[model samples]
Target: MFQNLSERLEGALKVIKGKHKITEINVAEAVKDVRKALVEADVNYKIAKEITERIKEKALGQKILIAVEPYQLMIKIVEDELAQLMGGQKADLMLTGSPAVVLMAGLQGSGKTTFSAKLANQIKRQGRQVLLVACDVYRPAAIEQLKTLALQIGVDVYSEPENNNPVAIAQNAIQYAKANHKNVVIVDTAGRLAVDEEMMNEIEKIKKAINPCEILFVVDSMTGQDAVNTAKAFNERLDFTGVVLTKLDGDTRGGAALSIRAVVEKPIKFIGTSEKIDGIDVFHPDRMARRILNMGDVVGLVEKAQQAFDEKEAERLNKKLRQNQFDFNDFLSQIQQIKKMGNIKDLMSMVPGMSKMMKDVDIPEDAFKSTEAIIFSMTPKERENPQLLISGNGSGSRRKRIALGSGTSIQEVNALVKQFEEMRKVIKKINAMQNTGKKLGKIFGR
Candidate 1:
């Protein structure tokens, strides 16, 4: 996820670490390194050169500031340029009309189908009645895959499996949506291995028949420069309103994301961050630049937390913490919510300075599996009253039983109980500090 590019850029910007001013000599050296880094990251050589030139020009034109370091200023300059290259601002989907139609277009294996379901899920979460239309008549079981995804996301689907006519399927889907009162229609069209006259003509015909509000071209970011070329062809034909980059979580060089918008003259509206249905994110260039520069995306992290954590459940947990009643039940519920927040390591990397610190650390995806299993093995009473297993009366026997039931060692069970108790104690300490703060406010009488 741009990790290599970030590390290389950081190294390039380090040229001005000890300098007090942004001199032309230092700027040239930095820009050269930056250009090399971008080229190595699969960026178009011309675009990379052009961007580095702009960065150099900006760096030389800026005055030395007393409040900011030269290296920090260089980073800011590069971040701004990168963001501008990737569509200076976020572009939102135009979901207007009684049943706003969005046509999906891209080459095969570009994740067009998956992104369609993801888009529908996103709109459905926004309080809209979304109908996912399956028009990929050539791909075997493409309609079934879409139906499965729609079912998982609790969205409706309109498909004519027997009818191989995608153009008619899309038109009928819109008519079906209008009759069913669905406010949004996402037509997933068939894609070819390579752009051809037949494939292009079919999608164009579907576009003409549907009269969609938004036409999104989904591309596989892992495809590198090929993705950009494919996007250019699609844009030339369909003139898509926006772009969607999928497989961004893979080991991609990120050239597609950096070059597609500039090449096609379209904004990147969405990015698939993970394989989960909820992994789709509205593209934000500024936040992306921050992440690439090791600045971290705090706002994005907060948004993910807000979406994953239930407000009512959090309020209840706060009350319990204040009362020192934070039990295993609440702990289990918290774990479930955190698991829904997507990849653990990716979530941690969103915090400031954590990405660099955890670069070499291997955080397993199943890190919480053992803990969850142990807790699930516990009886309802044991979960409600963790004290029952921690008390000195029969602690050892109870732990052994838990270890056996959970298929874990006794030492692991003991360690989990100890960690849980420590967490409860920390909550108690926080509650005490809050109480002390209130008492001091009363005493000060200010």
Candidate 2:
């Protein structure tokens, strides 16, 4: 997710490594690099320049505030500027009407169908009864896709295969929702390959017929600047209440996310990360800014963790983490918690600095298999405290036996032991920093 742009920005900022103060020269050099990073990431050059100019002004206006360095101040300034660029505040969907009608609009392959399902699931998580309406008449396959997702997620979908008329279908679906006590109706419509008059009229008719509470323009963030243009075209016809930026889980350059809000003057209500029903997230500006700056988004991470965290298990892990007694067993346990939360790479990016380190590295989705096997082979004592496996004691011999039992070499066993040791050290450092600092520490424990 904007990995390349992140690295480029990091490099750009490094140009003033030894500088004691912010100079027009250093700041300009850095801003140029920032603009280049945005452009390369598929941002419109004009929007890119506008953002960099604002970031530059904010950087130059930074007050030292007693002890902060220029570069550090600059990072803070840039984070804020970037946040403002991507919608200064989180915009929520207005699902106010009873049987609230939420209409989706976009170009074909822009993920309108998937996003509709995802949105339904998200609303269901809010404890609302949701009805997913497949109004995409052109593709019978689109109705199948939405139905499959709805069935997989345990949500209800309303479709009129025989009707072919989207506006009438949506009207009947709303009637069905009212009859069935469904609180929200998400109407997914057909999309053209490009913006066309026919597409606009169809969506507009649906809007008029349903008198929807909200109309969202779903655009593929992978298209970068074109995403902004697509949003504009949709907004002109639909007067969409919000925007849905999909495919951010891909290698998007961060351009669309940065420029869409500013250009369309519409709130970006949600983002779609994956095909999974749970892959959708409500847009939050501060959390996203924190993510972009490589500062871990503890708020977002905790929410995810809470959804999957078992109270008893989490408490047990918390005890070990606090005592600095986290070991290979604990590491494996944490990995399991992460895996249950869904995609490993997607969850990993929720942690700030981890993704940068993983950029060039390949983490096989099954990368943890060997670790799991080794842990399964370990005796209770060795799992509890890795010290038993550290030296040539009888326990060491037993661990060697376990390694062979697990069909892994001694080197693999040693690597696992070493990795656990390093993990404990890092966790201890983080715990100390959090406790010592107070605020950011509670985040880690959570």
lDDT of each: 0.90, 0.83
Supply the TM-score for candidate 2.
Answer: 0.81
Candidate 2 displacement at residue 302 in angstroms: 2.0
Best by lDDT: 1
* TM-score of every candidate relative to the true structure: 0.98, 0.81
In candidate 2, position 406 carries an lDDT of 91
Among all candidates shown, the one with the greatest TM-score = 1
Candidate 2 residue runs with Cα over 4 Å from true position: 312-335, 370-446
List the candidate 1 regions with Cα displacement exceeding 4 Å. none
Q: Per-residue alpha-carbon lDDT of model 2 for 84-180, expressed as tens digits?
A: 8888899878888988989888888999988888888778888999999989899758889999989977998898888888889999999999999
Residues 207-259, candidate 1: write the lDDT tens digits. Answer: 99989999999898999999888888888888889999998888988888998
